[model samples]
Target: MLEINLNPFTELQTDRLILRQVRESDAPEILFLRSDDAVMKYLDREKMESLNEARQLIQDALISVKKNEGIMWAICLRGTDFLIGTIGHWRFDKAHHRSEIGYTIRPAFWGQGLMSEAMQAVLDYGFNQLHLHSVEANVNPNNQASIKLLEKHGFVKEAHFKENYYFRGRFLDSAIYSLLKPKR
Candidate 1:
């Protein structure tokens, strides 16, 4: 495994979107994205209840980046700074050359192909810049859209665990998908 560096680039850009570090100014959008029941429906974590929570989340993400543990980027449209979503890798295991991918988008942006565009940039960063062997994502079995997106990116289903995650006082099933680096 190689020594990982979280701050490899200040920002990443696709044709329609820009992936940049999260900032305090993005709290309102973050709050809205994380608090909306529709947006949080399939996520295992509790919804963000206030702006403070969003700010804290941004701060924590920065800290994690500084520690080389993870990288989180706010997804914004080109020529605009308003955050519409987020995509990132967390739970990085340097020795294993792998990390878990996570993402969330504003409900308004759903079905627009924006998330898929942002994901490609992040995945390229992970495989090409971070030199990771694999990238994994965990999704609720019911989130067919997310599963489809992962599959579109060449990720293959690796496992399905029944009631593997205890969330909101009950166990929930999860599916794990992984995309490995192409052979050299």
Candidate 2:
């Protein structure tokens, strides 16, 4: 296994977006993103009810990155610091060279192809820089947009679990998609 650097460089840039470390100043936008029912609809976590919760989340993400357990980034437009979304790889299995990817963008940005751009950049980093062998994504079975996005990035559906996730007093079915490192 590669000796991963948990504290590697913290900024990544695509043509129109920047993925950087989450900050305390991002709390307001984080609160907005996490509190919006539309955005939270498929997420397993509860909606953020206060700015303090957002702050706590940022701190937790920082610690996760520091510990090399996970890496989360605030997605923003190039030349602007306003966070429009977030993307990250968590549940890292170092021995297996795999991790689970998660992301969300503001509702306004949906259907704009921004997420595809961001996911490509992050996948490149995961496979090339981090030397990962595979990356996985979990999505609600009904989330067609997310399914399409993963397909666009060459992820194949690997599993479908009926009512595998219990969220908010209800059981939700999940689809697992995975992309392996391309053969040289």
Per-structure clash totals for the candidates: 0, 0
* TM-score attained by model 1: 0.96
User: lDDT by residue for model 1 over 1-184, one digit each (tens)?
Assistant: 7688876445999999999999999999999999999988999799889999999999999999998989999999999999999999899988899999999998889999999999999999989989999999999989999999999999999999999899879999999999998776
Note the residue pairs that clash in candidate 2: none
lDDT of 2 by residue, 75-172 (tens): 99999999999999889988899999999999999999999999999999999889999999999888889999999999999999999899879888
User: Cα lDDT for residue 106, model 1?
Assistant: 89
lDDT of 2: 0.91
In candidate 2, position 118 carries an lDDT of 94
Model 1 lDDT at residue 7? 61
Cα RMSD, model 2? 1.1
- Where model 2 places Cα greater than 4 Å from the true spot, the runs are none
Off by over 4 Å in 1: none
